[model samples]
Target: MAISPFRIYDIASTFLQHSLHLTSTLHFYARSKNEYSHGIIYVRRLSMNLNDYLLNKHLLLVDDEQELLDMVVSILNEYGFYNITTAKSIKDAIEATQKLRPELAILDVMLPDGNGFELMKQIKQYSDCPILFLTACGEDEDKFKGFGLGADDYIVKPFLPKELTFRIMAILRRSYKSENPIVKLKNSQIDFSSAQVIKNNEHIQLTAKEYDLLSALYRNAGCIVTIDALCEATWGANPFGYENSLMAHIRRIREKIELNPSQPVSLITVKGLGYKLIVE
Candidate 1:
């Protein structure tokens, strides 16, 4: 129902602004004293102002660490999200997913006793809600694997809170933009149309950037698509001196396609040059 990017940006911006004001004022009043301490007046007024702008969105976060889980929970809370939940294990995450049926999920890769990727496979059986992976593994292969499995977004650990927030907002916006479209590779099936990937009947989650990179490679299979070619295709334009970003994308893509990202097979680095895809 929404077509304009500006409209979407405005919607998200308003949400962020309202959340910022609410959090700022609440903290302000809590630290103050005297008559102004009962500033429930301004707080409730802010909520009332945001009532019409509020989105009926629910978010679920899964991680093994208590501190990180709590940090993300707090961040989301400050963003005007009242319906949020956290799970420290895969089993707990599965249960919460079934019970709450959240609109979005932020998952971690490694978990206690099981992998988040395994649980993601199960979640897709019933829910098509978008998933974002917040993981400690920042290697290109790990990222590609995550996306190859069908995640909507991936953020490496030790990331900025603001970047995470911006990425989450972007994923949510993409999910609402029509049924997710699927991307196809040599032996794999990527359904961006549904934000899912299928390999031998197994579906997994991927981050948004992961999908974009993979789709670009797949679309130009066997062609010596330069790094510059890739940068422009996926990121809209090539930023001068930012060649590192292109390298990052290639490394990530190779992780999923090659048995060893370090020694790639399907995705080959031209060595001192650009890269090209080898579809078998």
Candidate 2:
């Protein structure tokens, strides 16, 4: 039986407000039969309470098990994660990615027909948001495979909901705290506030490393920044091992920004050291 979007939202909202004590002004909209949106209900900085659960954060939960999905969403709500979206299949999951673009994604390893690993790849192609696998497949090999696919954390199923909540919160906190603010480049244009670069009224998508490198250069413009500085700025202290990675990031950024990346004008390399941005 197909659940009407309106009824699903009504139940979700009532459950949050009455059951969880989250007095967020939720705007629940039916995205589709298999997709539901419960937008952020409130934001208050000073008074730390359960309201801290879902303030200004978006989370996407993908699982094939209806009970598991509801349980996950319920747990998240209990922790003040009211801003949640649910998907029961790979197709629904991909659609949710486009519609919601969540800051964090909790994926189950085995779907009905599709695997979470496949979905992770598609998500990575567009978003660098932290992904945490919540799967029953807890074999050592399975754990390693999830990590190799760029999962930030992998949790074995049949675990405590509170523990899962804590893991998600910790991952979210780490991801948020380490973000480098995007530098607004020339012409009242090119907003880097998010990872994507917007220039000439178009969004020039950048890889995670590319975005980070460009942000570092933009922030420290006009100074002859050294390679070490760039490396440390992007990857933290002891970035000597990842010099090649840094170079690739820089080259990619140049391609997006410079008239010709081959013969760069804006992002120039200083032979022995690093690179600098000449914002025009």
Clashes of 1: 22
Give per-residue CA lDDT, model 2, range 146-199, as digits (tens): 999889999998989879988988888778875544444442233555567665
In candidate 1, position 103 carries an lDDT of: 82
Q: What is the lDDT of residue 146 in candidate 2?
A: 91
Candidate 1 lDDT, 202-224, residue by residue in tens: 77666676666655555434434
Best by TM-score: 2
**Model 1 residue 207 lDDT?**
65
Among all windows of 10 consecutive residues in model 1, the one with the lowest summed lDDT is 36-45
TM-score of each: 0.48, 0.51
Worst 10 residues of 2 by lDDT: 39-48
